[model samples]
Target: MEKIATIGLDIAKSVFQVHGVDAAGEVVVRKRLSRARVIPFFAKLPRCLVGIEACSNSHHWARELIALGHDVRLMPAQYAKPYVKRGKNDAADAEAICEAVSALWLKKTRKVPLQPRKFLDFCWYQVNFLENNISISGG
Candidate 1:
């Protein structure tokens, strides 16, 4: 089996789809694992990078994967959308995320370190805007 340089996981309620690729952007692993098998499966592999769509449960899964020694990153769903080559499904979504994470354009933009408070400020602005809109317009 080719060593997995990165793996993209499509989280679901029961069956989780996983897609892995090698450094050359070749598919290495693709399967659907039951919720119970996620950690044990990842534990067997050598430490590798994992990309997961940023959803409500993603942080929880990310922590679990990190504990298994894999480097994990959360990517918003929209970032992974353009990579999907076919119809929507867990398998395709996993493949899309797998492709998105390894996109070369990312190399150009990842030069700067991301600050946590920038995310906080973005969230604050969103909430304040919503509150003010609701209060003044009564919509």
Candidate 2:
């Protein structure tokens, strides 16, 4: 089996689609994983880059995957959208994310940093702080 070097994970409420490519750009893994099985599945693979579309819960997932030793990037959903090449579905979304991420890494003007846990956390904190201040001022 080809060793996976990068992966795109499309996560929904319960099911997740995964598309992986080897160093030569050959498909090495394509599967669906239940929410409960995601951690276990990735835990067994060697550390690799994982791409996820940025959403409300993507940060949490990124942190978890990072803990497992994988480099995770959260790309804007719109950025990945243009990469979809087939019918809309979890599988296609995953593939699109994979392609988008690969392209993102190649370019030098990335808006989001790699291993963005700290940046994300700081942003989250800022949002919360602003929300709290708004409520206090309004009440």
Estimated TM-score for each candidate = 0.75, 0.76
| lDDT tens per residue, model 2, 1-139 | 6789989999899999999999878899999999999999999999998889888888788888888889888887888888889899999999998888888454532333346668889889889989888443555
- Per-model root-mean-square deviation over C-alphas: 8.2, 6.4
lDDT of 1 at 111: 18
What value of lDDT does candidate 1 attain over all alpha carbons? 0.83
- Say which candidate scores most in lDDT: 2
Measured on C-alpha atoms, candidate 2 has an lDDT of: 0.85
Give per-residue CA lDDT, model 1, range 46-105, as digits (tens): 998787888888878887887777877778788899999999999999998888777766
The top-ranked prediction according to TM-score is 2
